[model samples]
Target: MMVSYVLVMVIIIKGYGKRIGEYIDEECRREIEKKWERWEEKKRREEEEGVREEMELWREESRRRIGEMKERMEEGIRRRIREKIREKKEEIEKIEGRLELEEEEIGEIELEEEGIEEKLRI
Candidate 1:
């Protein structure tokens, strides 16, 4: 009778131990899954930050290029204006003495020179 009782106890212990082991394995799996989720979140945030920084750098470079282009355009305009002024001065000088000019025409030429000088100031 005692041997029978011992055998029943052994069977009960095996059944409950297997259930406990399964419970422990489930908890471990849950913890591992949670950690994986956190790691993925961190990785995603870092990638977004990297992309934002790259865009900022690109914007700065674009602004610099635009500024340089504007400077070049302004310089070209100024150069063209100067060349026109010089050519007009040469033409006026040729007309002043080489022709029989009226006083009014000479005055008009002087006024034209003054206007050209004003444009140069700008």
Candidate 2:
């Protein structure tokens, strides 16, 4: 009977030990999962910050390029306008010269007509 009691007590002790071990393992798993979640959150935040920084840099670069393009375009337009004005001034000068020549020819024809009339009246 003592031997039987000893065997039963040993079995009960082993069972209790297994239960304790299972509980410890469960607690360790929970802790590991919590640590993994924290690490993931940290990595995600870092990635988001990096992306935002990159986007800001790109935006600044784009703005700078656009400003340069606008300046170049304005310069080109100004040059074209200057060239057109020069051409128009030259055209006006040519027309004025032709008009002067025409007025001189008409004056000579009128003087000849008056001379012819005076000779006919005599």
Candidate 3:
């Protein structure tokens, strides 16, 4: 009788084991798919965040380059203005020197005329 009972239980387990295994396999596949979807979503969010950070860094670099260019341009203009001022000062000095030379020549001519007139009177 015990042998018969064991044989009956073995038959029952064999009948149901394949169906249980199939059910368990389907459940495991669904769980793995769910986990994969979550992982993909997380990776996409991380990539988007990285892109945002890259864009921000690019903007900052552009702003810094623009500021540097503006400063260099301003410095160049200042240097040019200083050079022009120096050139103008040099021109003014040359004109003043020429005027002094002309005055001295005119004074010498006047003295020579006076001396000739005195000699004629003697």
Candidate 4:
């Protein structure tokens, strides 16, 4: 009789232990799934933020390069304009000098013509 009672108790204990083990396994699986979901969500958010930061950095770099290019272009234009102005001034001076020489030649020719006309009249 004692042996029978012990055997029945052992069976009941093993059945209860199996049930508890299954329940614990299910609870642990649910917890792991929840943790995995949270981790995935966190990773996704981090990736999104990292992408945004990269885009912002690219935009900033692009803007900086563009600004530098614009400044360089403006400087080049200014230098070209200055060179043109200098060239124009040099050309005007050359023209003025030629006109002065032409005027002097015309005055000498007029004097020679007047002398020849006076000799003919004599």
TM-score of each: 0.65, 0.73, 0.71, 0.81
Q: What tens-digit string does per-residue lDDT give for candidate 2 at 1-122?
A: 99999999999889898998899999999999999999999999999999999999999999999999999999999999999999999999999999888888888888888888988898
**Model 3 vs. true fold: TM:** 0.71
Residue-level lDDT of model 3, residues 1-122, one tens digit each, is: 99999999899889988998999999999999999999999999999999999999999999999999999999999999999999999999999999999999999998999999999999
Q: Model 4: per-residue lDDT, tens digit, 41-104? A: 9999999999999999999999999999999999999999999999999999999999999999
**72-118 per-residue lDDT for model 1 (tens digits):** 99999999999999999999898885665667777889899999999
Task: Provide the clashing-pair count of each candidate structure.
Answer: 0, 0, 0, 0
Error of 4 at 119 (Å): 2.7
lDDT of 2 at 25: 99
All candidates: CA RMSD in angstroms?
A: 14.3, 4.4, 3.4, 2.9
Stretches of candidate 2 exceeding 4 Å from the true structure: 1-13, 110-122
The deviation in Å at residue 24 for candidate 2 is 2.0
Extract clashing residue pairs from model 3.
none
**Worst lDDT window (10 residues) for model 3?**
12-21
Please identify model 1 stretches exceeding 4 Å from their true place: 1-13, 100-122
Model 1 scores a C-alpha lDDT of 0.93
